[model samples]
Target: MEVYVELTYCMNGILFIMTYEMISLLLNINWSFLKILFLSFLSNISIVLIYIDYLPYISFLYWIVLFLFIFKKQFFLYFPVFLIVYFSILFFINTLIKESFIYNGILITPINYKDIVIVVMTCVFLIIETIYLIYAKRKIKPKDDLYDVTLIFNNKIYHLSGFLDSGNHANYLGYPLIFIKKSKIDTYQQLDTLIIDGLKKRKIDIILVDQVLVNKQSLRNVYIGVLDELDYDCLLNKELMGGII
Candidate 1:
């Protein structure tokens, strides 16, 4: 039985990319997906060449050079940790599936087994990475201090979590404003609107909400505009921070 070289290359390439992706996520580093894909494809060339030429020593040299060139020093230091975690998971799964190809009292490996391992390992890494990222963010904010905001609109009240930000110093004709995601309150009929063109002339719509309350302090005639994105449900402007805090 011969190995499927093409399948091996594809599996190795995917695994290489996933390993770095998890590493980047854990470190909270920003890496473009395209760069990761290129690094993965480039690193696996040495492995594919070894499978073809049967020259492990020379192939190892090329692999190391490409790996170090593409990845930073942090990756070099932490990659072994990734390998340990990946192999440990693969071993644990292998125990349950017991999918082994054996010939003459020796355990052989099927090409499909490699594929299954890659899929399983990638999933395990992603789950751990997501949980870690969530924890990393929450660790920075105190749970008890987070403010509860109530939006009164159309005789209907919507409750949301909010944070007072000093950086939100914008105002509309001296009237204080709050920031919320457009998707959260887009249903309400906006009383007024403003369009601002940035350096790239990207037009942004800013809508005004009639009323909002922070923890019991009422903010009447406040503007509620759309943010590019937000981590919280709402952000209270600095003008309202004095009343809320």
Candidate 2:
């Protein structure tokens, strides 16, 4: 709506000039502006090829909103990284699949402004999706009743509400915090090796390991792993919403 609006033209006598809307779109970009522009152009072409024939009149703003919400926080940081890694991986995979055992190549394609918008939008969408996934993982409040013999898995330590019993006492006369479960540990070798390695330089020799969640449940026949920590200092404290101290 301003007088400073401008335009550009393509080779076919049509005004293929940059518009005010496009300029406004680019205004918010900071450091990775040029790279963003290039990637955006590429994605627009892709969207056209995929949806142009069927969904004839799709608005650019719709894609923008979708991408912005999904990847609001990580858009700038991840977009360039995604572009670089995606192309590199794609090229390597394509070369591996081809008859030629070796392929060293370059990707050179013309940029269309529309493509830039789509790529940026899609990048934002993926970023938001990633955030949502992480949020979900964090939101999972682990239940105490579901576990027995919690473990200090290297850096992260977990607490388990373990059941103590006999038949499951498989410790070879060591300081392993043993527990009883009705199931078996799958790939015991790998788990043992991991626990052993975690305890090699620590204050403990072995661990109190076994399994948890007996049959007729979701976690059936699960072989639990644990290790002894010397300076194993991880604690969780909780307080009421409005309580002090």
Query: How would you encode candidate 2's per-residue C-alpha lDDT over 1-245 as one tens digit per residue?
Result: 11110111111001001111122233432223344434344333333322344543342333344445545655564444444444453354334333212111212222345533533554465456445444554464334423233343333434544432222333333422343221222222323433232312322222333322222122212333333331112111111101211
Clashes of each: 0, 15
Candidate 2 local Cα displacement, residue 163, angstroms: 13
Looking at candidate 1, the ten consecutive residues that score lowest on lDDT are 100-109
- Model 2: per-residue Cα lDDT at residue 226: 35
Report, for every candidate in turn, its global Cα lDDT versus the true structure. Answer: 0.60, 0.31
Instruction: Provide TM-scores for the models.
Output: 0.48, 0.25
- Give the residue spans of candidate 2 off by over 4 A: 1-110, 141-204, 207-245
